[model samples]
Target: MRICIVAQTFAPQEEGGAEIVARMCARELARHHEVFVLSLGMSGDRLAPTGEATGEDGTRVVRVNWHNSYLPGHKKPLVGRIEKARWHLKASVGAVSAKEIREIFAREQVDLVYAHNSARMQPALFEASRQLNIPLCVHLHDYALLCPKSSMFSAGGNCDTPCLKCRVLTSRLKSDGEGMTAIAVSEALKQTYLRAGVLTKADWHVLRNENLREDKLHRPFVGRDSARSDIFTFGYLGALSEEKGIEDLIRAFVDMPNRRSAKLIIAGRGREDYVRHLQSIADGAPVTFMGFTPPEEVYGVADAVILPSRWREPQSLILIEAAAYGVPIIATNLGGTPEIVEDMKTGWCYDPSVAGSLAGVMEKALKIGHGNWWAERDKLFPGIRGFKGTAEASRYYERLNALLVEAQRPDHLHLQAL
Candidate 1:
C-alpha cells in the first residue's frame, strides 16, 4: 500500500520531536509499505515547491510549500496559542489551494492519508483531506485539538485542575455569544471534526502503546544499571520554552540541596532570551548548555531527567527515553507524563503547582539505593514501547490498512491485517 504521511514540517527541514516522530514512522512504514511524506518547507532551505528527499538511506521524503506563520527568519514560531493559531491560519489558510492538494493526491495515487498534528489541529488541512476524498488518519501528537496552547495549560502556567475556561473554548463562546448556539457549534465541531468524524471516521485513529517489538535493545536496556554518584546530573530534554516548565525547574534546582556539584543540562531549542535567562539563573552552578545533542547522546549523558512541564505535555519522549535508559525521571504529574513515569517506580513526580516539589523529588532520587534503581528500571518494560524502533509504529500502519479495507469492503468483514 502506498502511504502519504502529512505533517507540519519534516526532517533536514526542521528538527523537533514531531519531526522526529514523522521521520521514524516514515522509515519504519517504508520497510513494509511504500511511504512518502508531504511536509511544509522550512525557512531558508531552497528547493522546488514539492520534491523528494530521503529519510533514512532508503526512505523517501517529499517537501511541500506550505506557509510558515513565523516570519522568514524569526525564532519562537510556536510561542503561544495566538502564535500557533496564526501559524495554522498561515499554513493552509487562504494560501495553498485545496485543488492543488487534490491534484497531488490524484497524481500520487495514495492509498492512505496519515497526517500528524498538522491536519488534526489545523482546519485548512482538514478541509483539504475532505476535498481530496482521501481516507485520513490524524495521530494525536499533543492536545492541539483540545487546547490552543496544545498544553491544555491556561494562564499561571500549570496543568493540575481539569480546564474549563480554556482560551479556545472561551474565545468561541465570546464569538458565538451565549446560549445554545455557541455550545451547539462547539459540540458539532468536536463531534464532526475531532472525535468521530473528520479525524477518525476516514480510517483509523492510531494511538501508540508504549513499546515496539523490532528493537531488541528493548530488554536489557543499556546505561540503566549505572550507579548514582556525587556528581549528580539533572537534565531537561525537549523544548526549553516557558510552557515547558523550564523556569520552574530552574527555580526548584536553585532550592535543591548542594547545587554546587549537581549538573543541570538543558537540551533543545526555544526562545533565546528565555534560555539565556535560565543559564543566568544557574549562576555557574554546574549547569552545562548542551544545546540539542543527538537523541542517543542525550540519553547517554543523562544521570536523571527532569520533565517539569508547566503545561499538559500530551506525551513526553524525554520521560520515555529516560525510562528506557534507566535514568530516573522527576516530572510534573500532568497529562501523559504520569502514564509514562510511575511515581517512585520508574521515577518520581513533583507537585507541578508548588515551588519546591521538583527540588524535593531530586533530593529523594539522590537517596534511592542502587539495587532499587535496577528494580525501578525493570518496571518500565511494559511502557518501553515508546522508545522501541518502528515495530510499534508498524502497528499504526496495520491499523490504517484494516480501517481502509473495511471502508472499501464494508460487507466483506474478513478482518484485514496489514
Candidate 2:
C-alpha cells in the first residue's frame, strides 16, 4: 500500500507526542510498504518553503510550506496573534493546505492518506481525500475537533462542553469528520468525542501510542538503588503547563511530611512565567527543576513517575515509558491514564481535583518504599510489553488500509447498489 502520512509537524520540529508517533509509524511502515510523509516545514520561528526530504529511515517526506495568513516570521506578539486569528478564520473556510495535498496525491499516486492533529491543516486535507476518492484515516491525538484549544482543558479542568467561543470560532469548519475513518489513541478520547457528538458516523478504533524501542525490551531493568533507601525520588516528565497540574504536584510534594527525605525532579519545558511560578512554589522544597531532560535520563534517575494532569490525558505516553523502565507511576485518575496504569497493581491513581489527593498518593508511594515498588514493577511488566515497538501498531494500520481498499472495490460497490 502506498500510504501518505499527514501531520502539521514532524521530526526536527518535535512539537508533541503526535509528531513523534507520526515519524515512528512512517518509518516502521516504510520497512514493509511504500510510505511517505507530508508535513509543514514551519517550526517555532523558522519557516522553510515547500520542499522534499528523506527521513532518517529513508522514507520520503514532502514538506509543504503552509503560507497561511499566520505570519509566523513576525516577531511582535500582537502581530503574531492577529495573523494567527486570520489564519484560523481562513482555515475554517478551507485549509490552505488542500491544494498542496491534492498535488502530492496526484504526483505520488497515494492510495491512502493518514492524517494526525489537524491544527493547521484540517478540512482542506479531508476535502482533498474526498475529491481524490482516497481513504483518509484520522488519528485523534487530542480534542482539537471538539475544542480549538486541542487539550480541551481550560480553567484547571476539562471543559464540560464546547464553549460559545469554541463554537463561534469553529463554526465555519466542517468537523463532522464525515468520510474519514477515525482512530483515537485511547478509549477515553474516543468516548469524549462520541459524547460530544463529534465523528458520530465514523468508524473508530483505539490504538495506544508506542514508547519503547524494540531493542530496549531486552535491556536489563535497573531498579532503584537499595543504598538510596534514605531518600525517595519522585519525577514528573512532560510539559510544565498549568493544565498538566505541575503546580498541584509541586504543592503536594512541598506539603508532604517527608519533604526533606523525598525529592521531586521536574523534567520538561514550558512558558517562562509558568516555570518561574513553579519555582516560587517549590521554594525550600526538595525539588529540582531539570529543564527538558531526555526521557532515558528522566526514567533512569526516578524511583517513581507522576503525571498530575488536570485534563483527561488522551494517553500518557510517559506512563508506558515509565513502566518500560520498571518504574511505578503515580498519576491522576483522569482520562486514559487509568487504562495504562492499573491502579494498585501497576501504579497508584489519585484525584487531581482534590486539594491534597496527589500529595496523599505520593506519601503512600514513599511508604510502600522502593523494594515493594520493584515487586509491583515485576507484576506490571507484562502489561507494558506491548510498548516494545510499532510493529503491532503498523500491522493495525496495514489491516485498516486493506479493509478500506476492499470496501472501495468494484464488486463491493455493486453489492451495495443491489
Candidate 3:
C-alpha cells in the first residue's frame, strides 16, 4: 500500500508539531508500506507548479507551489484583509486545486491520504479524495476546520465558540469532513470538533500526541536542587506569540515584588514585531530570548517550564519534554493541560483568566522548589514515558493499517480502539 502524507510542511525542513507527527507517521508506516509526503512549496510562481525532492535521509517529498494570498515563511507571513479573504475563499472551494490533487493522486496511485495542517488545501482535498474514491484521514493539530485563524483564540482568551467571521469562513468545513477518517490528538480536541458539528459522518478517533520514542530524547529529567542556586529560572518553550501567554508571563513576573530572585527565559521564534513588542513590554525584566534553541537544552537548565497559553491549546510537547527532564510544569488549566498535569501531584495548573492567577501559581512553584518531582518520575506520568519507544508510532501504523485493510467491512465502525 502506498500512503501519501499531505501537509503544509515536512522535515527536515520545518519541525512544528504537525510536521513532526506527519514525519513520525511516515516513518512508522514505511516499515509496513510505501510512504512519502506531499507538501506545498514556497518556491516556484503562483502557477501551482510541482516538483519532487529526496531528503538526505531518503525521505521523499513532493512539493506543490500553491500560494494562498501570502506564503508562510520562517515566521508566519502577514496578510492584509482583502488577500486574507481571498485565501479563505479559495480554501473553501478551489476547483483548480481539486483537479491538481486528483491528478497527483492518480499519478501516485496512493492507497490513502493522511493530511495534517494543510488548511490552504482543504475542501479541495476533500473533493479530490471523493472524486478519486481514495481514503482520506485528517489528523487534527488545531481548530483549522472551525476557525480561519486555526486558533479559536483572540486578544481576549480562549473562545467559547467560533466568531461570526469564522462561522462564515468555515461554514462548509464540517460537511466537507464527511466520508473521511478523523484523528483528534486529544479527547478535548475531539469534543471541540463535535461541538462545532464537524466530522459527524466520519470515522473518528482520538490519538493523544506523544513525544519521539528514543532513549536520547528521554534523558534523565533532573530538577535543580535547592542548595544549588537561589535564582529560579522559568523557561517558556515553543512559539513566542502572545496568544501563547508570553506577555502574561512577562507581566506576571515583572509585577512580583520578589522578581529579583526569579528569571524568565523565552526560547522560540516569533514575528519580528511581536518579538520586539514582547521585549519592549518586558521593561527590563530578567527575560532572556534564546531564539529557536533545541528543546533539550531548554529543558536542561530550566527549574520549571511554563506553558502559559492563553488559548485552548490541544496539547503541549513542552510538557512532555519538561517531564522527561524532571523539570516542574506550570501551565494554564485550559484545554488538555489538566489531562497532562495533575494539580498538586505532577505539575501545577492555574486559571490564567483570573487576575494574578499565573503569578500566584508561579509563587507557589518557586516556594515548593524543584527537588525530586517524584522518586521515579516516569511513574508520575506514564503517558510521557510509555509511548517513548516505537510504541506510539507503531500504534498509529497499526490502526491505519487496520483502517486500510478493513475499511469496506461493516466492523470498521469500531475504529475508536486505543
lDDT scores of the candidates, listed in order: 0.56, 0.70, 0.71
Off by over 4 Å in 3: 42-49, 65-67, 72-74, 176-178, 215-230, 343-345, 370-413
Candidate 1 per-residue C-alpha lDDT over 1-418 given as tens digits, one digit per residue, 9 for 90 to 100: 7777777566555555555666666776676677787765534555324556665456666655555544222134447878766664453234444565666677888766666645322454445555665555555566544444545566656544325544334222111111100011112223323331123322223244333334634444444566444466777787777778888877777777767656777777767787888888878577777787655555565667788787666666666566656576778877666655663266667777775777877776556533454455545434432343244443655654455444334243433222
TM-score of each: 0.73, 0.86, 0.87
> Which is superior by lDDT, 1 or 3?
3
Q: TM-score of model 1 relative to the true fold?
A: 0.73
Q: Give me the displacement of residue 31 in model 2, in angstroms.
A: 1.4
N/CA/C clash count, model 1: 4
**Candidate 2, lDDT over the whole model:** 0.70
**Full candidate order by TM-score, most accurate first:** 3, 2, 1
Question: Arrange candidates by lDDT, highest first: which order?
Answer: 3, 2, 1
User: Least accurate stretch of 10 residues (summed lDDT) in model 2?
Assistant: 409-418
Off by over 4 Å in 1: 42-56, 67-94, 120-124, 146-149, 158-206, 209-223, 228-230, 343-345, 369-418
